[model samples]
Target: MPRALAARWYSDHDQYQNERRVIWGSEWLMFGVTAELSRPGHYVADEIAGYPLLVVVDPQGELRGFHNVCPHRAGVIQWPGCGQTGNLVCRYHGWAFSWDGSLKSARDFGDSPTPDDHSLRPIRVETWGPLVFVNLDENAPALASTLGSLDTAVRQHAFTDFAYGRRLVRTLECNWKTYVDNYLEGYHVPLLHPLLNSAVDMKTYSVEVPDDTYCIHRAGQVEGSASAGVWVFRYPNLAINVYSDGMNVERIVPLSSTRTAVVYDYFAQDVSEEKIQSMVEMSNITLDEDQTIAELVQRNLDAGVYEAGPLSPRHENALAWFQGRIRQSTGAR
Candidate 1:
């Protein structure tokens, strides 16, 4: 990787603003919110970047999001990942918050009878494809506009009909970009993926950047090879891997300069327990292969041994295209 690109990974301002513009300022971020949240007060705790969040579907069937913190003393509102609660009550001061993050009640503390100034901060939220997304930027564009052509692709491909099947979160020793770059191309599949090679036809693989913010890779069988299904990317850092019977949506979340968290979600059309488990296993094998290469690349970048490498037009236009988009998005030359 060129130091200019790698510098984006290591620079404090670049990293901070990247998270601000891409993650917090962008459209829907994948979190959980299926029929599982049908109950009145059921809620789930989620984290983005370093901000913790609380999402709930209240009695009126309306979805709401909060900062997951009590404004009174800056205490955590929900400690557990999720459960039913009559109302959101701060454990520290007994202040209560409504489903919409409005202050509902408060215990005696001082002459301030009203808690109007104390409601939990609200976040913009939207639901699509059975997954909930939050936007920390209150005035950001609607999820529909931010997604652009991706909305058509997901719908036309019938991707939303699949149900949630499995999830995996793993920590890796690499900058998040390393993982994104590794995934942008199938050039290494012949050497890195053996079991996958048995299923995926490497020669027939090709990538399409439908728009500046979106890309998809065809993972079907090569003319003389065999693969499973098509893999897709929706810009910045979301991977949509479509399998024969299901799909996996993986997102890259950076935790630090050399650390990242990979959130993998698997979904299947049919809801059989056995089928779900098998899907998870197959996805894991593919991920392990990618992780091995990503870590090596990250190490080399850290050692300052590589600056920029040439793009192989034959096998890597997809990867190069992604780099170009990053340059445009971040204003890099």
Candidate 2:
């Protein structure tokens, strides 16, 4: 029988810090899609696990990533947003960086030569289909290796052809792991998500851990349903949910030991305003139901009434696999 993670694992600050150092530090994390930076000089700046990152397309039309910090005084180069510009100019010192991460100008330090050795720090970036992923640890395995069968799963679908429809962000008052725990299993669908349960065939639900770092959840489609959405979870915090009409990519960003930020980026075959609005509304209803139960579980973990429990071998193998991976990553007992 698989055992559930202890309650402390969900609420402990020190454990959370350790996880940040080990799991997030070395994992290949999905940032955004390639279409966002499709043109030369296009860029998007954001933070991943507190590490400021910038993704841009060079004059040569190649995707690149950097630390998003100016070398001179550690000033931020670009504010958090997306746009197209020839160079990344630091607002504090007017230092500019080219798309290839070379220092273009250091402005206003006469006779004090610009250090040829200094440039924007580079981060490892890669693309899988239309998605962009960056890894803090350059030594980690290639994104393809980590992705494994996920590539084959998404290949049959028109995922790359889908255009961005809408984005929904939610900050949940629970440990990041709590939300992931809820996401990795289908056991709660019948109890917590009545709408989802009515839509998916739970008896046909099955979970597969394709590799050490990801899980795939498959279930038979309900009668007359258009699609049986594919749910793929990459270790640490990335989820790709694909349906016949669209795809939803979820990033679970840990704000603190007990707080999490979840970003839902929805893309679809059709990008009409009416279709986007309908998709957003349906997604929100499903997410709201999940948020309620995840927060409630966190409250229970904090209350100290329950320390641990046994896993359901039939329904929670994926959760057990995820918890095991966390333990393996952090070397926690």
Candidate 3:
């Protein structure tokens, strides 16, 4: 019989810190979509696992990732969110960095020998289909190895050709793991997401753990449904949900031990304003239902009353696999 993770795993501060190093620090995390940085000078800046990252399209038309902090005073060089810029200039001291992360200039430091060493620290970055992923661990396996057959599985849908649609960011009052655990299984769908259950045939839902790095959730189609949809959850915190109308890539970022920020970037083949609005409304409704239960689960886990529970073998195998991965990654026996 599969078992639920200990309550402490969800609420402990030290454990959360360990997770930052063991899991988030080493995993290949999805940063954004390639379309976001389609042109030279386009950039996206954000924080993941407390580390600020900057991804940009260089003048040479290559995607690059950096630490986003100025090497001089460690001040943030780029502002948060996406924008277009010819060069990244540190507002604190006017230290300038080229698109490729080379130190272009240092204000008032005339040809200083140390300027050469002040270039932005590079982070490992790779693209899979339309998604952009970054890794802090320079030695980590290639993104393709981590993704396994996920690309082939969704290739027929031409996911890579999809255009950027919209994005929604929501801050949830729950541990990041709580949100991830809730996402890995369909056990709670009939009870937690009635609308979603009605849209997809839940009776035929199945989970496949292709490898330790990710899981694919396949559900049968309902009559006249646009598409069966493909859902992939990369270990730790990235979710790729693909529907006929569009795809939603969700990144679950930890704000604190008990708070998480969920960022969803929507992409689609045909991005009309009407389609974007409709997708937003439908996604909001589904996300509202999920947030409610995830927050409730976090509250109960903190109450000190529920230590653990047995997993439903038929419905929660994926959840068990996810918790096991956490244990394996964090060495939390």
Candidate 4:
């Protein structure tokens, strides 16, 4: 896919369209890690493509992803978030399911007649490092294969060893793609993020698109200092931003055509608690700036002020590449 075509597609709405039908539909979508669910029967609920989802760890410590809907009465098996429960019970009919999504008990059904096809639909589960991903399409590629060159980048960056520092969610008044576009380029830093401009060297910043699956951007810093930072944009949705002391990674999940909910996690390698607090403060400030600019862009785009925008070869090539990949995935070009 050419950069021009890619940029055009992203601008035209390929991000939301493709994600719902393609990325989240067939490919592996990351949920947290194996450690999050802790005990057997503990479950976390999330949604993708508007379908309710349940992630759980069994007695054997294996993690599984299941449709949160009960097959019997189509009632939701869990709430819209994570929780620990001994058994998944449908609130409507009292159908119970096991940790692995098998039907455990049906409250009201004849002995001869099946209460319902009560089993929960299973989503393919895969684990890498501490992260867990589920493929709604059963035959989709493994998370590692889909990761492409990012597997190496993730390992080299040692994100697996970084402990979770904080998790934050912000609902932004913008299209999800709008926020992603803002993130993919540094063109807005000097203008929208005065604080970030002081922290990151704008002139020395460079983005590397090793393949269609991953894009990495390096932030320039002082020599012989541990101030180097990198941001990895994993194809489709995840953003892995690693700093010297800590790291911040986020996934952009669209709630609607014009609204996005960003799930962010902050991690620290060996930083002190005070430093982590400070990093969190700085991160929030940066995110606030980004959300502000992104919202404005969304408003302008919605108003049709511009049909499309050009990506500068010098500054916006990475965003151009990202847009190109999106076009390729969705057959936009």
Candidate 5:
């Protein structure tokens, strides 16, 4: 049987630092929705892993991304969250940047203009459906290649019909991996989620890792299909779950070694407000259950009384797959 990752990987400060470098720093991360950048000068600014990110639409109607830091004294271009701006001017200082993230003017540093080399560090920005993503790693593979079969599954489900609805941010007092470990398996559903367990046939519930970068979670069968309630969890931190009328995208971001944030953006197609509210309520209910358990588990992991344990061969294969990728990425023993 495979073993769970050692507890050290969850709460250790050094291990967290290593993860920030090797895993998050190099991976393509979902940033925000494309609807937020519908017009030129509209932008979304936030931090992913450890990088302060900025994704904005230029005058040419193209999406561009940057480090969100002013090259001059490292100030922020915009306040966190979504807003429309006339230009990329540093909020702290007045340094201005061009749409391409090139240095345009240095508020009042000198008489001559600063070179483009001092511009905000540009990153890669791309969109899949309504969501936008950024990659800090200049050498990482394209989002399409990284998504692999997840793309096919998404298209098959007609997930592109989802439009940006609403977003919910939940801060949890646990390692991001702790919640992810909980997400990658269905072992606890029967014991913890009575409502969810009764709705889906547990015997048919399974998590399949068809690609190295993503996994598929299936619970029972839809009327005319092989499965229903299918969700996709991409390696490191992105999750996309599809429902009959809507979908929710999850971005599991690390605020620190011990603190994490779960950002949920809900989307729906031709669905009524009542139905959308019901779906969000269900998600919130399940989230509350998982949060309470995950926080308690995190405390135990940090209590220093445990190290590692055997993983469930039947239910936790996805956990093993996830943990193995962490080990491979971070060189953890």
Candidate 6:
């Protein structure tokens, strides 16, 4: 049996900071969707994990990504969130930049010798299917290299039948790792999520990690009902859960050591109001259940009374695999 990650990993500020540098800093994280960045001036700006990201389509028909910050007094080229911007002008000052992040004009700093070139920092951006991803590390391998078997699993999905749905964001009041640990296992489903437990056959449920990079879940639906069809959780922050007629892509983003945010993007074959409501409600209920248990577990870990416990050899292998990846990345105990 493998032991769960130490309690300190959940509540320690230092451990959390270390993880931000080694894991989140160097990984290819999910951004927005390709459909949003369709037009030439279209852009999506948001703070992903800790990076203030801006991925915009340049006038020359190219997708460009930058840190969204201007080197001149750390001004913002665009405000937070997605929108259609006419030009790359700093929100703080009048300083403007070109699509390639080079300074185009200083507005009124005429002949002042301009402190440095005042360029926006650039980051790597790529797309897999309709999903866009950004990477902070310049030296990290391409998004394809990090995908592992997730590429095949997502590709084999019947996404052509579905249309992109709206995004639902939820914040969890616990350490990010605490929520993630709960996400990587189903041991609590029987107790925490009774509705989910009844919807699938508990006996046939299995979580397998064929590759260390991703985890796949298999279960027999109780009533030919469409639950998450190809439920795959890639290591770290991405989970693609496909159903018979719809699916929700989950992104786990850390806000701080004690807080985490989950972004759910639903896609459905049936875009009707009834179908959309049903899917959203189901996801909300499940998230509510998971959040309740995760937050309580986080509190106990912080209290220092409970150390790490033994993981079930049969059921918690996913948790072990996830924690193992953290151990390797952050060098935590």
- Candidate 1 vs candidate 3: the lDDT winner is 3
lDDT of each: 0.72, 0.84, 0.85, 0.73, 0.85, 0.83
Flag the better candidate by TM-score, 1 or 3.
Answer: 3
Give the TM-score (vs. native) of candidate 6: 0.95
Model 1 stretches with alpha carbons more than 4 Å out: 1-4, 7-18, 21-27, 33-35, 222-227, 328-333
What is model 6's C-alpha RMSD? 1.6
Candidate 3 per-residue lDDT over residues 1-333, each given as its tens digit: 878899988878888899989888888888887878899989999998788999988888888889988888998878898999887898788988876677888889765646567788889999988778899888998888766777787776567778898888999999998999888888788887777888788888888888777788888888776546888888877898888768888988998899999999988877898888888888888799999999999999999999889988888888889999888878654
Instruction: Choose 4 or 6, whichever is better by TM-score.
Output: 6
Question: Which 10 consecutive positions of candidate 4 have the poorest summed lDDT?
Answer: 1-10
TM-score of each: 0.87, 0.93, 0.93, 0.89, 0.95, 0.95
Question: How do the residues 1-333 of candidate 4 rate in per-residue lDDT, one tens digit apiece?
Answer: 223342233344545666677766776666665567767877888875476788887778777788887787678878887777666788788887776667778786657234335578988888877667777887887777777778888777777788766678899888666787778887777888776777667888878788877778877765544346678887666888776667877877777667778888778875577877877787888898888888887777767445565678877878788766556667765
- What CA RMSD would you report for each candidate? 3.0, 1.9, 1.9, 3.0, 2.0, 1.6
Residue-by-residue lDDT tens digits, candidate 5, 1-333: 788898888888899889988888888888887878899889898987677888888888899888888877888999988888888889997987778777788877767564756878889988888878888888888887777778888878778887678778999999999999999999999898876776778898889999788888887753543125578899888898887678888999999999999999888885577766777898887889999999999999989999899998889999999999998988775
What local lDDT does model 2 show for residue 180? 93
Clashing residue pairs in candidate 1 (N, C-alpha, C atoms within 3 angstroms): 1-307, 2-307, 199-226, 199-227, 200-226, 200-227, 201-222, 201-226, 201-227
**Model 6 weakest lDDT span, ten residues long:** 110-119
Worst 10 residues of 3 by lDDT: 109-118
Candidate 5 has its poorest 10 consecutive residues by lDDT at 221-230
lDDT of 4 at 284: 87
